[model samples]
Target: MRALQSDGAAVVHRDERAEGFVLLSPQFKQRWRFVTAHMGNLHAVLDLAKVADTLLFVLDPLDGWDSTGDYYLSCLFAQGLPSYALAVLGVPDLPQKKQADAKKKLGKAIEKRFPDAKLFPLNTEQESLLLLRHLAAQKQRHLAFRDRRAYLLAHNAEFVPSRDSDLVGNLKVSGYVRGWTLNVNSLVHIVGHGDFQMSQVDAPPDPFTLNPRVAKGQQKKGQDMEIQVSICPHSQQSASVLMQPRKQQPLQSEVIPDPMEGEQTWPTEEELKDAEGSLKKRRKVLKVPKGTSNYQAAWIVDDGEDGSEEEEEDDNMEDEDLMEEASQVVESSEEEELAEEECETMTIAESARDDLYDEKVDEDEEQMLEKYRQERLDQMFPDEVDTPRNLPARVRFQKYRGLKSFRTSPWDPKENLPRDYARIFQFQDFSRTRKHVFRQLEKEETEGAMVGWYVTLHICSVPISVMESFRQGMPMVLFSLLPHEQKMSVLNFVVRRHLGNSDTVKAKEELIFHCGFRRFRASPLYSQHSSADKHKLEHFLRPDAALVATVYAPIAFPPASVLLFKQRSNGMHDLIATGSLLSVDPDRIIIKRLVLSGHPFKIFSKTAVVRYMFFNREDVLWFKPVELRTKWGRRGHITEPLGTHGHMKCHFDGQLKSQDTVLLNLYKRVFPKWTYDPHVPEPVPWARNEQQLFMQELEME
Candidate 1:
């Protein structure tokens, strides 16, 4: 029903009574009549022979007929219905497990019967609609064919002509030549096109193996496809009786030819010999002895009778032919010989190439050996020797000296020392021009606080304790003068602020060199303190403020000491400094006083072999210091007038028998400023003990 509706077929009632019978009957109806009163009980049992090309069977599940579906189908096949003719329709109450089995059985039964039926399994209403749709299609094709608008082509013995279709119009058929045979209901079947599946099927004849009559008929039919108009030849002569059309039906069985008729007769050896003897006799008859009467057979040489002029021309060219054949043979032989010679030459060349390759390899190995030998010689006796083990390189580190007073000093015009201190303190002037917001403080007080700020010296990290101490004096306060709503505070280290203030006094008075600082907007103790010390001060400082300071940031320092150098030629020791001069003026640096003092005590007695000197004002602090030494030079010298003025170079060439003794003596005498104070308690006694214990365990282990 769905398919019919999709194809646009109309539904109409022609036999109302018969339709009711079909709906009520338990058996499937075989046929339908136009008269409504001529209805009969639809017997579900099928008669294969009576079934038409279009068989419509409608079954109903609600009527309670079940389990015998396969049996019912068997009856349809038994009566000779074509497989494709039958249509089974129903809402059969078939169990899921049994459905497959039932379908298989029904399919087998149908296939056994007609083998080409188009079986449709559908419900009652569906079967009725499908049949109607098929009938309507037939009517349409019939009208089209009647109008000569469509051509019908039939295939096989079941010859139903193709109802006209615009899609496949006027097609020429070629394969196998024979036209289709169709039944009245338009069902088609091929007569000889009944080829079975290769497996489990009888082998089909090869293309050449033909049923002779059928083959001839097919050929004739193919030729008939090409229509020819006959033209009469002008023939007044009467035609012969031998040329009549064939009317005899060809016999379809095998026929034996006459060639094998004497196969049953056996020949004796003598008879076989006689047959051979007859051939010998014929040869002997052809041979004529030279002197015999039959000897000069005229047939042997009748040139004029047997030979044409073309034969004489061929005979004249025979010498040239012999010459050409001889040349061709010679060329072929020469080619073969040349190929053999090439092969022998290639073998000899390859052998020579191998020899040259071996020689090159041997030369390379010799070169490598020579290089290895030279390297070994170089290792045994180096070009230059290093200094004796007892002597240490001459190098020195010393303190700097500076002006005695905190006030600005005059610069020497001759030496280029500034007459006005501004030149020396250019950065300080620049520092004053910078802007800073002093929150909630008088202008005079803010100005006074901006005097001389101090910075902590550190190699790397800032000391936390020092920073914390500085933070205690700096408290948070609202900056009313500022436009930004953020809160800020300023530490009043008066000297760093202006000239001097009470807060500055409260801060440590001494310029604590090497005191590191980490800047923080909030207190370092606040939750906002970052773990890193080198972060931009802007993180902690306001944009308006030029500088911020934190004194307790961690500091890293290398172990450095002021050491004297002894000139290799001299045996004098010099004292580099007097006090623990954290910083010094350049003039006060005792460069001459610096000397190398080793184990045997280079200073025989005290003529003051080493003495410190306090020079005229010239010094450097953290910002101004000398550059350190280079690895290759005898010693480094500072040309700058910064703290570098104190640099000294001394070398020790005197043999130091014991290095440890020399180091101890040098350390004690040269850097007298370095000492361990027993009065000051050790900060980490446990750490010291643990280190000792670790060393002991390492030794034992």
Candidate 2:
């Protein structure tokens, strides 16, 4: 039963309900709803924040907020924070002597993260009521990532199965539409779940409509949202299905490459006769096979006949000879992180009475220790690999070629790209494309369901298990995909290493990401974040320095924040890094460097003889064009080889000491691994680390 108005004011029913309710205030004359959620629940807090107009954080009076709270706060700030307010409960319950001190300490703590935010003491019901008044009147701050897209916070979701299949069904999700108008023909991506097409949209009655409350009063009220047409008529569905030619967007993520559809067309008799009559003298540009087409011949010309292949074969033969004595062992470190742990995840028991001493031993402890030592060694000697004493240096380091200068040296981004690069997309000008997309979105007035409209989307092909998960209280968020946003592209993110994570993170390692409303796993290539066109690749993610993380992902425009996470053995995902989207440029050059160190055989004024750099005379001559350097701050070059056994005379700007090591810096372009997965495993939900108090009766006998 609803509460009757008393003295010209609408009041809530005395009975408590699980569902959220909107407040109808007589003092402020406004309607509002309160969405309360447990801060410790990871998915709950984040998914709710996405569609929320305002957030009110409740802090403890004694202690502001713990480290765990701070961790989630950083995530919210990075993902995009809407207008928020802070409040402290139980402030008046504190002792008179400690109340002032607690308030002062709380001010200093919150000042760091929220300097301008006013701290409200909300112990009394009256104060809490006043807080809502201020919150409703305050202006809201918009998140750039969410402002231009249509999204829904799933308040009520139900799966209606088709008669043919129980597994597949149309998921009817209802909620208020936020952001820009949502087009019915567009695809919607359910967070965590994959993208699905909408069958149709239905306008439903708003559950939180407060118009009935004013009907009980004596005064006439203004008309708010009225539920006119319940289900959309059949006429509108035809218009949505058969949209204008230009209005329809294609769902193809990749362009199909066809070999049979080339320029191998047969010439007609009329064309052949005309060519035979007119062409007395014709130039044969390229010599191709009998059935070769123009496209295949172009590739053949670009890749010269035998000269380059024979040269590469000779180099490979020489390289193989050097490493004939020994083979390097390669394995992925942290096997637990690489492979999924099948063991049961352990959880903290609730009560002290059920105390069970938890003791777990790591089987690979020694391997982890050795890996840490190797990481330390790499840090001390950055990229320095010792010369193989048993084998020739040319074979061990054949894959690398020396660079004159990492910054100034020219390396084409298109050269030596892997096969996966062909399947990816590239943008001519990302900034201009972004502007045009946003400009088109602003013209959404002619189509789509407008904001604040209570509409249900018929998400086709959603599994029944998704609805079961929704019933279990998992946060459900759905976002409309923009044009071409679902296509694959090389995405670059400007991120800083998360300070909380001390474990070593390296390039080309698989990591889970939360970018805007999408979560996925991808292997990213790391490079120095710089203004120059060419960027030096980093083997390890460094602290206190920003790095550009390049990964193959679906195209998302800039202004989206990125949160990087790595899975732990216990099934929890740890936040390792955070930043924002940089760009979608596939042409950015990232060069990986390998250092070859050699000892100075003999030192002289402006000249020195170096050994162990190359095993054969042919190897020295091939790399003579490349530059060299010494450990003691000297620049040099290989003038000529003194002997066949890898001894080369070098000229330097300054005299080199005998103890100084001769170094050759070789570089090659690096690319991310082809391991882009959209369905990232859901991590163990966040739980509060509650302390249990144990009491024992006096041990007396």
Candidate 3:
């Protein structure tokens, strides 16, 4: 109240002393001005446009019940009034932890909408008077910035329009001035009773600037006529005037008047003290009144003390006697009321017990309902050992469900399924059934290229997880894209099962072989024989078979026959003579050496001999000379191919082969240690002799 008066403003609050009239400060009383009736209304927010230069709304978060800080702040924004929030007093105590979060959320919400608006968190010790003083100083500087600015006064109190007021024309502003990003820096100053007039003005300078006022040294931007702030300064003296400390002021006090009415009221200290004393006594007398209605206490206060001070003395004696009668009557009535209340409560308890009994009876009814439900289920689904296909769809689907349930169920198995039903649904090739599928997938020992394709297979009821696991186990074969025929063919070879009605195991479909294509040919045969070729006939007829074959082993085959030699980079030549019969055993390669070309010898070992070169497959007679070129003299090492080259020359720096005849001393040679499995197939017949020779040369150790 003091701060508003200092700012030449007025405030109002409801009062009973003045009846319809409001009270205000001494300064307003001297001018005969009071705050408006609208301002005095507690429910109404003060129309700040008719009050002071800047509006400050001090929001008490705790004042309202269960207030969401966000909601309260948003209401201020919705009003569309350019008002500021004084938040320094701190948040109100909320029922839950959400209040703290709500406070921060509300701050962010305000920042989004009113980015430039100032928010001050006033310290708890500070009051509105201190804040208002600071704002008044700020407004003084704001007015100094604009030249030719007019001041408006309503009922002797300074008034400023809200930011939304259109009358405040856009002022040419530079940078963030006056401690704010000035949106509209000047207003069309219109004041007085009958007619309003406007005058142009320049906006204020930044409040943080050193030279805020338009003084002598500074040149004026336009016509130099500074708008002075009409402020009513605080009149009370400082601490020097007070002899001792005074009581702290309460925040909320009744505003006596709204200045819009031009009336003022300021009460003397003595008069306020008398009112407080009388009110205290009245409350004490009414504290424990005798009454069941609660109406008798009010009648006592009004009737007993209604008259003036002189009439009150005359009734003082009557007051004590009246009080005794009132207490006795009230006590007697309370005892009677208590007895009636107890009876009513007993009736309610009995009603509740009856209700509980009825609820138990209802529970019995539900059990009967459930019993009927079970009977219906049993009748609809009678147990049958064998269900016919000609039965209803429901029965058929149910029977199928039952059969499938038993297949994977944890129950005891019934006897074998009916013979007729099994025969009808039975697999022709039971190799594709679940039992055989799992069995076939586990088998490993197989021959040939270890390759087979299924020709016809259709999968229906298989666990997805099982199928996925099976696919992962087979690394080399990606059977996802293979034809069904190929999968069935492979499964048939691997998996086997007995037929439903027979004992025979199933087999895969046969494969077709193509031999030759021919036109008209000669009838009789003409024969010519060379002596060298005749001797080579033994190799082509019953040649040797070798067990162990080294990876990437090469054979040498001449035009007459095939010969195997273990050729080494170190020029240590060894041979298993041609026409030697070599065979694979369980632990080693068995060789039968025949004296066809080289020395006849037998090699029973774990390692294989490289015996033959190209004959039936491709080129038969071509010999390229070995080229020798190197400074290291490391004997034999093949060079990488040159550009556009066809064949790499075997550059034997040592004089050995231009298809030269070389003999292997089979008795003196060394071989690497490697075991051979005889179950694996042998090389082609003609190449067998060559391989035997090579093994003899490189004898297995």
Candidate 4:
């Protein structure tokens, strides 16, 4: 095996016998685009998966089936590719029984994951040729299917309106039309924009090259050609923002102020007496000895000579005790009298007899009762109290309720959906959308002029602002459109309120908002606002604000031949997202969706002897203790450093054999940062510059 120094090591084997046969036999000649993908490199797998027509998964008996291999298998299956096959590599001189056992074990493992896939032993040249023939047959079938589908689309072509030019008269709208036979006079219909006559056709240069295998004499003229057309709509297509349902805020209970304050209602006489009796039963008094007075305690001698001062102090103390007794008696008597008076007043107030002299008291009582009733009414109808006579009796406010999982839920094509539900976007004429190519375009391009291999459109109609977000580098996507028969009624509502100074102030008091895939900006529809409005706007700037805007985003319809949608890109597009089929109906289909791309992570082996590519020692250290997962659902963690080279010791729940793979999952938050030059050669190497060397050394340290 000859090792190639590239992004990763690639092994090339040349058999002398095969070389001579190749020189002699014309049919034996072959060309291959060999790529060596490092384990755990999802990006490399994704890139290679796009170009590879068939997958050949090689399992080594000595190394065994590891998590790394399993991950690649899962990725391949997920792609829903055309063909799959497996090859078991082992020593040619190994015992026949041992080889048979190894093959059997590997076959069982592959069967568990991919039951339909064919397995073969890679022992001799004949076996290798058999695998090659199998792949070639699968490729032929795939190409035949694609050619037939392309022919059908070309024969019955349809163009859906994707974008319109800004010019007014004879508006030259540009969109992609599948179905090949479009001529100068082809008539087309634009859904709501009305029927129009094609004025000119602008065929884009074919992006695909001619097949090298086709003999010069047998080569067909104008193969794989696409034409861009310019046409004028009878009337300009109306532009409207597709709105999603706004989330509803939780209802807040009203706060009512206390109306009766300061005044106290005295308890009835009987109730007061009962209260006093309970207090007496609960109170305890301690007795004091009669001879233990302050005067007696101070007198140490009992002599009668000059004892007159002591006698005076004793008399004073006796007088103070009498006064305290008198005060207590007076307080008890006063409380009894107050209680009696309160009872008398209540009796008088409850008396039905009308007396002229008691009119003043009755009037005061009536006034108090009226005030209490008015306060209750105000609490019940706070809004009514402030509403003007001209205001309507029923006031409706716009409401929004957040969805737990918006992708799988049924949403109306006409109603506004929450921004978070804007996971999938469907472009009507996806082929015409500007694709960003690394190489410069031959002609002058607009801001969103580069046609990407994939076109993304929101499943629901997006706002003009969101549609314009392409300028801000939002990813372009093509969503699987919903079928017409599956369409449902969507509730769309718009509430306009004239917040006169009072409403604005109240709204600004404590404002809260929601932000997700959608953005919110103040509309110009409302009249001038006070300082409170500005404050409310500032409050929305917070990251956790729950504020959302309501705009009508129309639901997009899926293009024809939904199953064949994958073939639309013709190997040029990348599968950046995946969705699970929720339910299918005669008219509609529901899907649970997620954006496919994420940050890239590395996985290291847990074995004592590590044999894989690593840039430096620091790479190993940084990955230490990081959790690694196997494809079969087992997990392990890196424990310690293995050596000076980039290797580490890892521990798993169960002892891992040489065949077990340890992988670390990483994600990509933004795709543009990870973009590569399409025209650049594969396995791009690090430049041998001072800066590169320094960076490499820094990683090592």
Candidate 5:
């Protein structure tokens, strides 16, 4: 009902004795941030829940628990906090028998949701002290699960031009390290940027503290810290280099000869004249008479009888035979030369033909061909458009239906029923069960409230670089099959791949598939609903359905080398989903891909005012540490205390002006730390992890 403003600090509310009586124990002092129910802002509640060590759910005996109260309770449960306490008010004045019965009924309701919560009476001072004691004891255990200790390795770095003439010799850098343990002495390796000797690490003091005190020891490990490092830029490259694909080189045999070789050759004038004379002389063609017969006559040789004559004739014959052998060898050499020339000509022809076939069609020719095809179709069906055959005869042309607004209709209890109405349980009270299950949501809503909500799921076994991005607060969304419509189809595809070509039937009906933080278990049992239940579930399968089943599967950190990170110039890491294995089981298939789509904008500095693109004052709180990058690749961070009208002050390595364009990157990197691994084999239903230990204990009771 009251609000107070504090200068240079967050507003704090203090209750006076007249307004509300307070009881303080000497042993411990408690600080509370009161959040009212009528505010209707769930984000504020969630933010407060993150900082609260323990949660208290207050219930009035007379009012009992209504839809609004259930909604708040569900928000608290969604946080998955370690400690919870329930306080039932207005029970002290009731009769002993009635009080006992009320306590038993309330206990049953609370146990169903928070099995491990401690119960107490609101009017009892002793019980309040006990709740505080329990919360203090569990604080350390919860902190261990929430805190992640990791270091940030620099992904990109650049030198900032010095503004002051005195600091000309020194080089300044406005880059960030994505991990913790960064100090003045920390030697950071920047890819594509040399490892400079850091002279000073200038970091802004914590802004939350009203009167900040200088820390004597090393700085604490937390979210990404923007620090300006003054260093002497190294002239030589660093040992660490960004990974890149290797360039392919041509092989020796595949290399082509130089074109200049053929051009450099020249024939002498004497050789050219001889070649011309041979062409002029041409072939010695033997001319035949007009009346000569076409067929050639065969000649036969006769044998000689005289012995002396025979010896002389044999010598002449040997000389003639040797001359004939020499002529044959010359002719074979000429034929080989001709064959080589023919092969060269054929190769040239083939290359020319290939070039002609591969040529692209002219734009004019393409248009002409399309026109011809359309004309031919038009001639075949002259009135096709007027006499459409696909549409129903009753369908009205140019008339629009309100199908787009169908989901906005008011809730009708009778019209909307559960999926399995035909197979209703004999003893089950459907209305009571619905109220109990959907206590956190509005009464009119029938589907799950948290179905489409996006949360960053930690992945284990990711590459060291990707892990650095995670540590820096990059949100990696866990896309589960429960939120998707085509989950059954994808499951079938995976099963078929796993079975290969074998026609053997799978013995088991149920199969579990895990990707990132999502764990999906599908079986025939899930589909075993009554006819009415099937109808209800089928409604959810529609494209416009608002409700979905609540998925409570365990999630864990992704493994190394499983995800890829690409650091953009605006200081946002774009997740490369390609080559990412979505599921290790079912033959390690890669199905869906995701990218971190951060909001981007341009800003500039004017006379004592910072100008930004399309952001209101309310949006400033959501996007902290708004990253700024200049056109020249210089980086900077916007300091707290944003100005009015989408304007905010920024800190950069160098000087800037109104005309200079600065890009802004805004994204949520901090995510809830999950404590359980969903991929562990043969996990007991109740004995999953320490978080579930209390639930298991309660289930046994």
Candidate 6:
């Protein structure tokens, strides 16, 4: 270790906040870049790891890793670990008799987290050299999503504000372009900021190697990258920029909504003539439901058997149903008004009782207990919402309909879609389009800097404050976006709830998602991760198995790993789930299942009378076709309505048990809430530097 330092490796960047080194020396086999920071500063670690190809963990011999180490390990593992090397420090200091036992215990613990990797002692210079060799020889695991895009790790960052506005400026960021060749015509995304366009890219000389041809005291080019970063003074803000682009990349995050879409529009003159001709010709049509033909329908029937009487009967029945519906609606409004008054009085009484006690309540404890209670109730009665007492059963569950078989039933994805769907872009055939785009990118000539080149990018209109973060140890990353990647689409991820976390993760709960290089906040709906046509919505993120998370987000191709995190009150992020992208499928159907329960009032031979399932005879008749089951496994269907009061005569396969409960399963297609935000503020640093002041503060407490 001392000999290597004597040889002198170049430090690409160094400051009070961060220190970076690029090993271009002849002693190393491959180029190596190292960035060191306190693990307590999570922002620095997460940003750096996204572009880093390998991770080296240095550990103590006696205590390999404390609680803090374990926390970081879990985060790294959840975020998809790159090639890693584990080096045990200070093995020579330990007593000879205890060294073997120490290594055995450490190996056991290491095996659980890193099954194939082994520990190396870093006490001797020879051991250190061997570890580096192993790292260089190890096969680099290529991540799918990142492999298709171009990104860079900035070694130098400088901002030159525009003459008009100090807030916006041309930020110069220089680094080695990795992955695919970067197209200057594309948009670049920074870590914290949303997206910006690069004005131009300048070919910079290799900062790692000194050029003998350049004269002394030349300011334009320098061998030291860090020294070149602070080239211009504050007073002299003007700096020479290369040729800028003639046009800018379009910033289109969503599809433009059409006001006339899905609405009646004026017909054309040709279409009016066609309509008149169609009205003149009377064509016999056999119509059932919009999509309900198991076999076929006979459109042409004998003129004598034209079914004229059947049509009259159907029209009369529809009229009577509409009249009954209008009367029930009036009654419901009156009942709802009375219910609201009772709720107001109850709230006032509760507040009056609260005035008796002083407000020293532990809100955190109370919230935790409430969360646990809700979770327990959900497990016992999954997806159970209180039955409305003010509204009719038919009106209350209008959006919901019963399914014969929850697994095999066909659901139309385009039916009953929310208005938000209009704002998103949908691919006609996602798989075919994905393949075509990649093939085109491969054949097209890249417009900007090629990969492995050290180029300076002048990103226009970047906030001056955003550039300062780079100097403060927050690693600023820049990645180019692919074609159509900015448009919003339905994204699915196959993720399993992290076993280390026990907090119940509910469906549609706001969570921070890290998809490879992108981080965003979304409340996603979870479904079964199977390849089935229809998937049942899960109330809880089950830790025992993997599930699919459906969210409306910017379209990112699969092969990218996913990490789900929940933010805590103390400003720390807890890892919830980890997985990879499943697909970008807008047609995937996610149905929320609701269970309605009622008790049997009377039991008879192969027949039973049920109550409390409906409020009137109309609702019983409306849902007569829906199949019913019991807790004891008896299957039945409603035969007839007993009376106006909610009682119904049902026929089961066998004798009904008086104590058994009757259950009905209803389903409705649910969409994720439109709560996607791409920006995540940096969290406060918790521990590093051995926690000197923090440890003292803790001891004082």
Writing each residue's lDDT as its tens digit, candidate 5 over 1-701 gives 11111111122223331122112222343322333322143323433344334556677664457654554454344333445567776787887778877878787777777687667664654555565555445552242212221122111222333445322233322222211223332222221111222344333221122222333443346421122212323314332221211321111111233445335458899989999999778633344434322221000011221233432332333333433443475478669978975664212245444644654544565575565556555556331232122443124221211111122423233332222221111213423443453353233332211221111111212224333332433221111111111111111111111111111112122333332222334321111122221111111111222211111122122120111122222332222111112111111111111111112222223112233332334333323223456555555544332333333444455555545555543211111111222221222111113323432343234
Which ranges in model 3 have alpha carbons more than 4 Å from their true place?
Answer: 1-51, 60-85, 88-90, 95-98, 116-118, 121-123, 127-149, 156-701
Among the numbered candidates, top TM-score falls to 6
Candidate 3 lDDT over residue span 1-701, tens digit each: 23233333233333232222122223222221222222222112212222223445544544321223332233223222333335444554455786677667656655665676554544432444455444534532122112111222211111233356533322211111111111111111111100111121122221121212334654455432232222222213221211111321122111233335444478899999999999878664444333323432332222232223532342233433433553465478669978975664212245444644533242464575565455444445322122122443232322221111111333222222222222112234433453453354346331111111101111112223323322332111011110111110100000111111111111111111000000001111001122121111111111222212211111111111112222233332222222111111111111111110111011112111111211111111111111122222312211212111111212223433223321210010111121211111111111113433432333222
TM-score of every candidate? 0.14, 0.76, 0.16, 0.26, 0.24, 0.78
lDDT of 1 by residue, 657-680 (tens): 222121100110011011111121
Which residue runs of candidate 5 sit more than 4 Å off their true CA positions? 1-26, 29-39, 62-64, 71-79, 93-97, 139-145, 149-701
lDDT of 6 by residue, 408-512 (tens): 777888898888998898989988888998898888876667777778898888887787777777788888988778789899999997876666687889898
Q: Is candidate 2 or candidate 3 better by lDDT?
A: 2
RMSD values for the candidates in order, in angstroms, are: 60.3, 11.8, 58.5, 34.8, 37.5, 9.7
Per-prediction tally of clashes? 69, 0, 52, 54, 26, 0
Pairs with steric clashes in candidate 6: none
Q: Evaluate model 4: give its lDDT.
A: 0.31
Q: What is the per-residue lDDT of model 4 for residues 595-663, given as tens digits with 9 covering 90 to 100? A: 111111222232232323232345545444234555455654444444443344444444355464444
C-alpha lDDT score of every prediction, in listed order: 0.24, 0.72, 0.25, 0.31, 0.32, 0.73
lDDT for model 1, please: 0.24
What candidate 2 gets wrong by more than 4 Å, as runs, is 1-19, 25-30, 93-98, 123-125, 214-248, 255-366, 389-396, 685-701
lDDT of 2 at 282: 55
Candidates ranked, most accurate by TM-score first: 6, 2, 4, 5, 3, 1
